[model samples]
Target chain A: MKILVVDDEQDVQVLFEQRFRKEIKAGEMQFVFAFSGENALAYLNQHEHEAVLILSDINMPGMSGLDLLEKIKKTYVKPPPIVMMITAYGDAENFNMAKNLGADDFLTKPLDFTLLKEKLKTIN
Target chain B: MNFDFLLIVFVARYLRTALKNTQQNSVWDDRLKLAMYVAIALFVASVIFRDAETIMAWVGHLCLLGCIYILYKETFFKPAKSLIVAILPYAVVATIIQFLQLVLPSFYRGNHSMVDSLKGFAVLWGIGVWMVTIKQKKELDKTNEKVVQQEHDNRIITAMKDELEVQVAERTAELTRQKEALETALQELQSTQAQLIQSEKMASLGELTAGIAHEIQNPLNFVNNFSEVSNELIGEMNEELSKGDIAEAMMIADDIRQNLEKINHHGKRADAIVKGMLQHSRSSNSIKEPTDINKLADEYFRLAYHGLRARDKSFNATLKTDYDETIGNIIIIPQDIGRVILNLITNAFYVVDEKRKFGIEGYEPTVFVSTKKRIDKVLISVEDNGNGIPQSIVDKIFQPFFTTKPSGQGTGLGLSMSYDIVTQGHGGTIKVETAVGKGTTFIISLPI
Candidate 1:
């Protein structure tokens, strides 16, 4: 199954890949990383119905995960991908903002890869 | 040489002196005028009937008694002008008696025809003196009438001055009241002006955020899509590698998969941040509704974390939550209180992040949010383990425009606005407890 990871920080993407290196090597899962909300959209427009799950950070410079989640929920019709909001700030307001925008779940960083992997396994 | 002639002379002289004294002095006693007539009769009777020694002695004694009355009137009653009239008659009587006793003593030795004749003349003289004294009293009365008129005018003038002073005092008090009211109105106007400026700033921020969010989302969706497809192709290649097809896997392995995954993850994170920025920038207005305290706290925590993460990517903090299920839903304006929670959490994270940069070891940044119900109040506490606030600045944290954060990172209004939200908006209390090295805990109490 293909999973999309969205964060503005390049280091965050490296951490996620490193943490899930075993799963990717075993061919059990595949990971896609988008550096920004704009990059994520650009990748999505070219290849549709590819990402089965989206793990996104709530805060970024230009386009945020809640906005992206809103667009994904609004535009997609059938069997939408599960969108989980991830933030370093475990603030209740941001969590509510993401949930209200139709996020499937929420998490905080330094990415709890164990829980994230388990959560992703359920979606898969 | 006769007793009656002597009496007549004394009565004339006494009448003349009494009239002259009444005219000279502004205040005179009316009793002095009546006593003068009694003195003339006493003197004539004492001289003409000299053999009636007892009657003559009684007349002399009455004259002496009048003199004593004059002395008493002069001494004790001197301050009052009214007492002068009371003593004037006594003075006239005493003067006549003095002349009769000293000048006509032989006439008082026995009764004689000449003395009898003299007594009739004395009566005539007494009538003449009474007429003259009456004329003198009229003249004095005219002068007294003028003095009374002057005194009346003085009293009226004094009353007018007193009334004017009272009016001035009242007007001054009214002016002071008006000035105080004007000052209060001026303060209210200044506060309104500040609020208008804040609203204008928020409006511009909202518009800018919405535009930025819209522009970023379009390109972000594109990157996310293509990255997902690339990952799928990489996955298919990985499947082939597991099935013993290494050549195809090698062609697709290093470049496409790595870059595409980077685009997907970070792209969505950027999108979420822009969205949060847009939502947070919205102007605050009263939106009262029933809200779950626990859920509200969780949302603000995430927003606070996102805000801190956006500033510095390396900041890491461990967060813990202990929500009391008993503290159920409470009515509130979510955004207002949400901002409060967001500010506290952001401050907590900043404290930890700053501490870490200074090579502080043996301590991991920790934030604990706990909720509890006590009687009729719900308490929400945000506790942070970091370099605690300094003693000098701790008391000033909730004051408007006060901050310990670096200039660009803090507007200095975060804690103040939070205080307003908790105390004024929600009718609750917000307090902070901190130790120099231990950490800080912000406790918010809301009435259920």
Candidate 2:
């Protein structure tokens, strides 16, 4: 499965990569990273129907995660990819909106990779 | 010039008389007046004793006459520029006077020689006056030099004092700026500490609430399930009763009725408290967006006061709101500001609650929340009518871990966190004004 994670913080990307390095190497998951919501949208526009999952952070400069989710839900045609929301504990309110916008699930940072793996396994 | 000399003599004599009458309290030196008196007296005597022919001869000797005029001019007329042209002339006039004293005896008769001798004596007296005036002029110049030196020293002292004043002012301004910065830093430190404490408190509350919720959820599930079962049983019993099986129907009805009572007993009790905890924990986590400040304040006011009421059944206070209708909307994190308002309102309620405990009959606690707009700034104010905050403790109210409440009752993080929200988090200001018995007002100013 191809998964794209969008976040403004570079350390968060590094953390995900470090946690999932073996999975990526084994070809169980192919990972793509975008540092901003706008970049994520542009990537989705270019590679439309390729990725199976998108994980986006809610707080970012320019376009936010909720906005990105809204745009994705509205614009994408065919079987749209599953999008999960990632937010801090203080921002738990957006989960309902994310679910309303057809998001797969919501996770808070610092993410529990073990839980993430279990959810991914089920998807697989 | 001669008229000026006469005026000087008359003025000096009058001044001397005035000084004597006043017991010489004047600052003017005595030698100057004395010299003026002597010069005037000698000048009058010389005029009266002059030989008409000899006076003509002296006039015919222009150099001698010029010398005498220069001496007179320097000594009695103008004292500044006259000296430059007067020195040589003075010496020449003195020699001519001496010569006239010697030669006039030969030109006159034997008896007239006595007059000539007297005239010589008068001439000698005139020379003596000139000598005396020259000496006085030297003394006057010395005195002037000393006055100039004193004036220079005074100028130096005045300049030094001016420089010192400027330095002191600069230092005072620098100290004031430093003091303000320190106050700001102290405020920021307090805010961060409060936030940390609040987060910790919420964390603990979240754990406790979740546990309570789970425990309540189980009992609620049982109530709901049993209620449905009892309702089914009632329907079945009614069917039996309709079919004329009366005993079986009555027995079933009793069982159903018993279950219904149990459901009513436990269900409502668990639900109310659980719902309250749920409301407390379910803080919205939406990101900052354009939100109406007035609405935000109202929401927090209700939640905070309601939460306090739940904690203490006796906590009752009147709340008044004065929101500026024109202060539209601002971009801010609604959740954060909501929490801030909740904290402030809660504190205000607490203050009023404490006051109500000790308040006199017919006195009720009151909390006022208000908002206003001024140019590009918005002001939000919270005030309370209670036993006013103590003077000594008012400044420490926003300090983290500072509270009048007993240990477990208050962590003292509310106002500190609110201060941060109004100041650093939003680039605004928070100030407090209070009187000992009149109550306290906290005003928050934020950029629009």
Candidate 3:
């Protein structure tokens, strides 16, 4: 399985790399990282059918995860990739917005990697 | 005739005494006395020698006429106005009486020689005329006295009126001066009061903003710390799994999972704080409660200073505080006021940190915070010895999006929001004074 993680914080790259290091090395899972929504969109354009699951932070300086999710749902229909919305806040408003924007799932940070792994197991 | 000469002498002596008793000052008076003496002396001499009657009689008549001229001068010439009316009437009567009696007497009194004393009617009429003359003279003297007194009275009244006018003019001038002074004083007082009110309002708003920022950071700090610690723990867990320590790896995994839960909980808390901040700002629903203003100020002052110090180790500055113990507690939105104090102190710290980095010789960075309790209000001041704002940019400091700081370092909303809060929320005032190289002081005032 391949996964794409989008966030603004540079430290998130180290955190995700460290968390999935064993999985990546054993060839059980592959990971790609994008620092922002714009970068994620740009990467998706090049590798449209590459990532099976996409995880994005909702609150960002520009082009929030919800907006990205909406764009993905509207543009990609055949073999549509699953997009998950993640945020620091688990507030009802954001959950509703993400659901309305056709997000595959809603998650709050700091992410429970165990639960995240369970959710990702059924993605394919 | 000898006895008549003695009587005439007695009459002269009586007349002399009466004239002397009047105590008048006049050459005319003396001449009248001399004429009286001449008339009496000649009458007496003519009687002593009966044969010389004709010459004596003519000389006496001349002396009497002299007396009349002298009397007229005394009556009419001395004062300016009184006897002019009397002079016409008196002169006409005296001349007609004299002409009728002395110049043409026999033609008028009915030609009766048998009543030879009927010509003596002239003598009777002469005596009556003399009495009338005396009465008239008295009246003239009375009129003269009244005229003199009226003239004196007019001068006194005129002087009194002049004095009153001068007094009135002086009083009016004094009143005008006092009115002008009072008006100026009132204007000065009004301006100062307006400034205090503006500062107090800004302070409250600033507190609101600072409270939001500080409150949000707390949960973020927890998440960041926990994440870092969990990463380290995960590393241990990975190593334990590699070593095939199954029980140890499980325990470490459980610990990591617990930390992750805590991170999630804290993240939600941060979200809640942000939402709450927005709600509070919108609803204006915070209740004004009693809080210790001095304690609030002192607390925020330290928090701002320490918060900056923790972020940048190389940044150093001295903090000074003066709190008015008398301002025990006051009614306010404590969280809101706290934010204001924090912003001022943080801004002060930022400037001082900048100055420390610049490495200027003989320059010491210091921030001072003070609170004062006026009779009707509270005053707070934050002072800093750093790079003070320039004069040209001072007026723009409180405008939204107007900042001297570089783009990334500030949102430029701090001072503008502070201005709104102090002025509109708390009915307060904010003031700033700065010199480019010296220092800056921000003053906030809130009415009790």
Q: Name the candidate that leads on TM-score.
A: 1
Native-to-model Cα distance after best TM-score fit, residue B57 in candidate 2, in Å: 12
Estimate every model's Cα lDDT from 0 to 1.
0.67, 0.67, 0.68
Question: lDDT per residue, candidate 2, B1-448, as tens digits?
Answer: 1222343354355435534534333444375476466547644654665655455334334433443354456433334233324333334544455465667745445546565566556446545755675687679869988999999999999999999999999999999999999999999999986577657449435434433543354346546645655666677788888999999788777767766766775576466445544444554553557878887787556556544543443456677899999989988766666666666676777777777688578676788999999998988888987667888898899986687889877767767767776777788888888877667788888887
Cα-based TM-score, every candidate: 0.44, 0.36, 0.38
Q: Name the runs in model 3 displaced over 4 angstroms.
A: A88-92, A109-115, A122-124, B1-448
Candidate 1 lDDT over B245-334, as tens digits, reads 887677557646665666665576566556545445656546777878787677566556644554444555666899999877889876
lDDT of 3: 0.68
Q: What is the lDDT of residue B43 in candidate 1?
A: 67
Q: Over 4 Å off in model 2, which ranges? A: A1-124, B1-62, B69-77, B80-116, B119-123, B186-190, B193-197, B235-244, B278-448
Q: What's the ranking of the predictions by TM-score, best on top?
A: 1, 3, 2
lDDT of 2 at A101: 74
By summed lDDT, which 10 consecutive residues of candidate 3 chain B come out lowest?
A: B80-89
- Docking quality of model 2: it rates as incorrect
Given candidate 3, what's the lDDT at residue B252?
69
Candidate 3 Cα deviation (angstroms), residue B110: 29
